[model samples]
Target chain A: MWSRRTLRQREELIAYLLVSPWVIGFLAFILGPMLTSLGLSFTETDLFTLEFIGFENYTKLLSFDATRTLFWTTLYNTAYYVFLSIPLTISVGFFIAILLNQNISAQPTYRVVYYLPAVIPGIAASLLWLWLFQPEFGLINWALSLFGIEGPRWLFDRKTAKMALVIMSVWGAGSNMLIFLAGLQGIPTELYEAATIDGAGIWRRFRNITIPMISPTLFFVVVTQIIWSSQVFTNVYVMTEGKGGPANATMMMVLYLYRVAFREYRMGYASAYAWIFFLILLVFTLILFRSSKAWVYYETEIGGQRS
Target chain B: MSGAAIGVGTARTSVKRARRTQVFLIHTLLIAGGIIVMIPLAWMLSTSLKPPHQITKFPPIWIPDPFVWSNYVRAVTIFPVSFLVFVRNSMYMSLMITLGTVLSNAIVAFAFARLSFRGSRVLFFIVLSTMMLPQQVTMIPLFILFSRIGWINSYNPLIVPHFFANAYFVFLLRQFYTTIPRELDDAARIDGCGVIGLFLRILLPLSKPALGITAIFAFTWSWNEFLGPLIYLSRMETYPLAIALSFLRAAHGVLWSELMVVSFIAMLPPVLLFFVAQKHYIQGIVITGVKG
Candidate 1:
């Protein structure tokens, strides 16, 4: 049908055709919703009617009065979770990766055991942990008894709820371990050999050769974990029975936004909450990206091509 | 000379002994860590088989003395909506979404990777940047959009968005496509294979591992998704396994054994996938840094 058209034009047309679905979806799903959400933030609605509320929703959420809203509590709770979970999970994952990177027998079997928990569906894992964390009869407390230490009320106690979640998140650090392991394996063995010949001990070789080489991987894990963990909802929702409670101790921003939007049907208020949450995430990600240059080492830079 | 050689030999043997001890210590630590990691899962299995009497005991039973295999049956049939319905709903949605994800991502990625059209670079950058936008920002509007279109309680809302191609998968596939040599495309075109022909015959056929990775990621993502199903499907009958398993606790009063049985059932597909196609699964995960 396009025989008369030049080959280049035909190629361009075909390219557009191939990509149109994604472009259309991006506009319809992502861009359009983003704009509509922004518009919705300015108006109060309940799915039936809309009233222009201006910036009331934002101000209410960001207000100093913690009594009027649970926004601060949710933010604080989420921050607590994010800040604590990231470093712990990263360190644990990196440590495991270093262990697995050693030339050892039954390596694949060890890897499978570690990665198994990471693949369990979130809901199932949450359910499993809920049972495991039962204060009286749970295996955790039972094990604690064996060590002659009394176990604290985990998810049931507000003071320990966030800590319980941090512990659970660390269990699923197998993927991070795998990523770090890949990075570890990628380090040329010759570097370690040369260092050893120069009388560099294990710690010296690890610091000088290993750490710099995998700095990029470490940076990647941190960034992704930040973005992902900040939106943590399923585990908290399922375990806490969608309440984030034991005095709202585990109430994350997304869960709070969910309640406001779906439960209360406070569309405008929820949209505002959503936007605020988005900006906070954006700031964190931006800061991480900016800071990455100082730490994230790339071999390509020395090769004179910055990819 | 003999005395010096003997000294060197002694030093070498001592070094080897130290290395052996190091390996032994590493193995010991690995075993200890592995047991710690496996405990939760082992307990889940134990809990699923335990009788009601054994479940709430002070010291948790490591093994169920009277193993109640009937918990699985009770779990499935005791619910108002049978667990089978939830399984069917989950499988249908997961399969459809996986199909959509694989097909859409591969085609769009092909365009960006193989064709050097005007503005493709800019468009791909937009695709990548979208990854940073949190889902919560769009959640409300999307809920409104789907509700306005009368799509709630149906699989349409859960499955349709995947057909458009997600940015992360597109980026992954595009990366995969570029690693294939351009010479094949050139040779195909010289033989009068058009653009579509090249993609189908030359590219798609050879991109099995990449596509397999994409399919596995999509299937697992769909299988394990919680928030989407939670928001979209409100009715018990329409609920996927994730939603259904969560509700089991709320609806049934501490039916721990039954709940475990259902949770185990819900976890089976993805866990089995990981076991069966572990290399591809791990590769897919590592490639995109996507995790459960």
Candidate 2:
């Protein structure tokens, strides 16, 4: 028989062997590019030149004539989108999951209907939404006429364009709702029975039992949703043609970064923008993690404590 | 307990009626929401079938007068390149990604879950953290790297990355592998099974659910990937359905009729796969979040 030390060494070697591919890929593809982008952010780069300019790109983004306005506008648009979509998505998802969780007929059929959009490609879904939002001949306006409420030009009008994106986002809310439903199902039936024995109504049971049980999943959905919404690009790119237009109303940061990098070939400046956006997300995520202790519940532990 | 407190139970009758009405209202609201959610998709199908003039007609034709089967045929022909090429390329690349990711990630996940080693926890955490890094931050440098490697203008950038294993899939599979009984491994080891044998003979057979889930996710993600293929593959011959569809949109200049037909065709693979694996996909999404 092999010695314990030799067996342990063999196991370790196998572990390393198994994971070597990921390690190499991460170093060559992910780590190398990530560090290069960070370094590039501090430099001034153009089509013909690149130099270490020491915060020049940052300063330009903050105070330069045109860049500053673009930066702030993109930030505003992203912030507005993240704020509106996160709550709306979570609430809608949770409510739908609750209804689906009930002992209702055709539950499977309802689930498939809700989740159909979530499975479709983002580009296809965005294209479908674009047609739905057409101003003159769109079905939305047609439906509105029956109620005698004239719909505004959705994608054309600046005020309604962002709202239109938000509306489009709701179609795919089924993914998050599925998560919430799973979380809801995971809550023990005993807990509900106990709450009922204590004379708790449905609202009280939900408030005291269901919410705490699902808080961790809720936190996960919220954090990821915020991160995703802040980086929204594909829809805006396909729908608006990277214009951020109808007077720059829908110009998200990632869309702006695409225009900078690909369209204008301002690689270094775009790198800086990318890093700044990363920093904002990193900071916000850290804050969310810090605050999670207050809300997130660990089932294995009592007192609703964080793990 | 409340049964004893309600001696005047006619009030309870009215309250029960009120609760029933409230339940009815909630169901009504849910049905309305479902319809609103479905309207855009419904309209896409409707407009795609409408004739050219009826597409933009006033007060819009909600349903086509005669479903124009010809529009789909025209959409297939309108793009200069064959749609079949895009479909074949997309299927091949997506299948490669799915197979590569499942095999590589399952091996790594088996290691992480069943094996004991120093620094394993830290390394696993690092893998998880990588998922948080947005792809945009690395897109430029990755492009430069691929260009230098002569992997650009081909499917290498898209397919080869799967060999390394994605962080999300790795983490998911690890969780799944951990749930298998350790006694199985112990028993297999006593029968002279090496680590690889244990993995192949014992664990792999039992991990069908996770493998299925991973493959489905990999297929869907690869199929939907637009930005990666758009940047890397320059030649028209190398384009996927997503790139092909975008080109169709650009060529037609947002011709609603053509765009609708092309979009529906583009949506087919994922929609079909979703219906096939609906139960598993929904279960995967739910369980990942709830368990984590």
Candidate 3:
């Protein structure tokens, strides 16, 4: 005959058991490694040996020419990819979303058409693009010649490698387009009708009503896309064959960090690099959230102050 | 009055004409966009069937003259090991990850959604935080951990973390589970259902749609996952489709025909599965989009 106290305790125990998978995972995988990585960043550790080097890894990343160059170039490449792709993706995705959300016949078919490329595995897409980007006898160049416009050597050209990646990103923007479409559908028709009564053209309704209504989603897409695309790997790895050449022009931060850890075995240095990237991503994310206050419209100001 | 009637007729005619033009223009633009997006895929299928002689020709063969059905066979057999191993490995990984993620996430999500325990809010927020946490930092250390555990060159590294429940999926499921009314959970408890019984019978049975979404997303992610498999599964036998496909092009000079054929094959499952479950797929994307 258990007492009520023991029964309540049993319930609590069950609750803890229910959540333990995630809690244990958080401890074992996320929190544990995060702290370990942080600790290791300061200490240079070969597998068999460990020494507390005291900011040597961090200092070298900033001070050494080769390390700094690698770090900066990768960061720059990542920034370029993110900056170019996010706006292009959001804009084009928004445009396509609007088109599909209309009273068009066969909207799902068109959505599927646009979305098909997105579902294709990234590596497969990269390979297909690799063939298409072949300087001579490539489909893109061949198609370009038909229009009498000399095509730039896309992936092969250092000047255009990142651009090629941006172009690739634009093609796969359909997934985001679906998201924007979802946001668009969630907008009430009454609001639009009211806008129509208040004297608005198509472009005006879109710019003022649609854009503001979807701004929160826009913020979401922008932040997440920037975060994800900054870590773009498979494309770089597959297209450039893990070399990040010609002359490391396409080397992004993640790739560089991977090479550092696995290829060079600079575990401490790579951890340091990883933490820096993490902080940068975190800062960017925070900045986005802060700036979102200006542009992101909320229906009820969820989790924020009501004006 | 007659002139006014004639003006109205003209106005109506012009409006009809304008609307027709608008419809035509929308289709045209959509069709054009569709074609642009499909060119790579269309070109892939076309290239895969072309004879080797026509592959690199300046006047590229737009369509294969003799449809070489044998190219698919060649692609599978050309690799040092049977290409089937990679496909099998990838299929197993994707299936396991999907099941593990769906099952575990549903359990954890039930805990978060129903249990009003101390620190539940904080714990739920931690789950939310992990969804957006930068993985690069933990990647190396995790790799080290896995290697020390003798999981390197095996499927454990790729498959085990997912069994712990993906943070994104947990939040997604948690949102879904909350909609199933607290009354049901309470009634189940009164009916002698324990927490596990409540989850298995009341929650999960009703959460099939959410589970479906989780499964689909996890499958696609696991299938396309390049970097994880690339890092952990160094052995040729353990290589998944992504790594194996990457190696195919790198090894033996660029075999365009075989590469294209294999790529087309590699692409079939997700594309087909996507089409089959596209409604759920779209909902998954939308919910994730709105939620995030």
Candidate 4:
């Protein structure tokens, strides 16, 4: 039999060996690139050589109109998107979940139909939406026309492109809808019964018991939605026909960073833009985390098993 | 729940009538919403079968007349890239990446879950934090590193990173691993099962569902991945369904019939996966299959 000391050492060695892939990944892909990105921000790289030019790339944002303008427009577009998509998606999803939780028939069919949009590939979804949002001949405008309402030129008109993007995003909110469904299922029905016994109407039961119980899922959805919304690239990339166009109206931060790094070959400048974007996300996430204490309810803290 | 779960047992006649209306209203609203949500997908299929001219018809033909089955052939042939090539590359890459991710993530997750080593908790937290870091943050530098090593146009760029455990998958698998009681480990240990034996014998067998979920996730992600392949694989031969669909989109911008055919082709696998694994799919989503 193996000695206890040797056995412990072997287990430790095996542990390191098992997790070594992550250690390597973290160093090579994550931590290494993170620091390299910071370093690359201060240096220019043209695939062969890196030239250290200290804060010049950062300064270019303020000094150069094109770069500064691109930054501002992308920032505005993304901020607007994140601001609109998160609340809209969550509220819609939560509302749908509550409806699904109702004692309605054909629940599975309803669930499948609701979640179908969430599974469609972004490119395909974009193509489908592009057709629908067409100024003419598309289903959306055609439908609107029947009601005597003229539809805006979506994905084409600069004014409505960002709105179109947000709307498309909200359509795919079924992922959060699924989560909210699970959260609703997890909520004890006994609480609803108790509330109803106390003469609470449906609205009051939802307000007092349901919302507080599902606050953690809300927090989860909000945080994840923010991250996903901020990284909106594929739909915009395809919808704008790879230009982020209509006078840069739909240029999200990631898309702009992409144009800088790959298209323009301003790797250093792109790195600076990336770092600033990261800081913005970091700050927002921190703020949300700090604010979570006031709203996010932990079942474990209130004596339930789940943490 | 109000009547059944409570001691009230049954509602009065008026209340029951109101409840009937409420239920009817709920079903009506849900069915309406479902129809609205399904319209785009329905239109995609509708357009796929439509003849070229009918695509832009003002009335928007709901069904194709004489159903142009040739649209599929033209859609596949019109592209400089082969649809088969895209599927093959996608399958190869997705399978390899899935195998790599599921195995790597499971192994690493096992260590984090069962192996109490120095820095394990901190490293696990590192895994969780990586889930928060957006791919946009690392993409450029990773591309540079890959291109430097000439992995730019190959499966290596796509597949190699996955051999290193993914943060989200590791977290998911680790969560699964923890749910397995420790007494199983003690029971196995009495029979002289080593650390590897405990994982391979006890945990691995108990984790078929978790592994299934992880493989499904990894496959769907790599299959649906566009930007990575778009950046790395510039060669037409290496294109996945996602990028190839983009090429057809870019080329024949108004060819709605062809676009729909290709779009339907592009959509088949993930949709099929959802249908085939409907139960597992819902379970994965509910169990927090880390939002992509």
Model 4 lDDT on a 0 to 1 scale: 0.83
Clashing pairs in 3: none
User: Residue B184: error of model 1 in Å?
Assistant: 0.9
| Cα distance off (Å), candidate 3, residue B277 | 0.4
Q: If both were scored by TM-score, which would come out higher, candidate 3 or candidate 4?
A: 4
Q: Please give the range of 10 consecutive residues that has the lowest summed lDDT in model 4 chain B.
A: B1-10
Residue pairs whose backbone atoms clash in candidate 2: none
Docking class of 1: acceptable
Query: Which regions of candidate 2 are displaced past 4 Å?
Result: A46-48, A67-69, A305-307, B1-27, B290-292
What would the per-residue lDDT of candidate 3 be over residues B13-88, giving only the tens digit for each residue?
A: 3447777788688888889999999989988999899888889988688889899889889889987888989999
The lDDT per prediction is 0.87, 0.82, 0.84, 0.83
Q: What is the lDDT of residue A185 in candidate 1?
A: 70
After superposition, the stretches of candidate 4 with alpha carbons farther than 4 Å from their true spots are A62-69, A302-307, B1-15
Alpha-carbon deviation at A184 in model 1, angstroms: 1.3
Interface RMSD of each: 8.7, 7.8, 9.3, 4.8
- State residue B166's C-alpha deviation in candidate 4, in Å: 1.2
Report fnat, model 2: 0.55
lDDT for A41 in candidate 3 is 96
The DockQ figures for the candidates are: 0.42, 0.38, 0.38, 0.48
How would the candidate models be sorted by lDDT, starting from the highest? 1, 3, 4, 2
Worst 10 residues of 3 chain B by lDDT: B1-10
Predictions in order: chain A TM-score:
0.95, 0.95, 0.93, 0.94
Write one digit per residue (lDDT tens) for candidate 2, span A1-307: 8798998899889988988888887897789898999888887775457888888888888774763548888888999888888888789889998887664445666677777888788788878888878887777777788899888998889999999899888778887777787777777778999989989999998888888888988999988887777888878878886688888999999888888887777778889998888889989999999998788887766655432
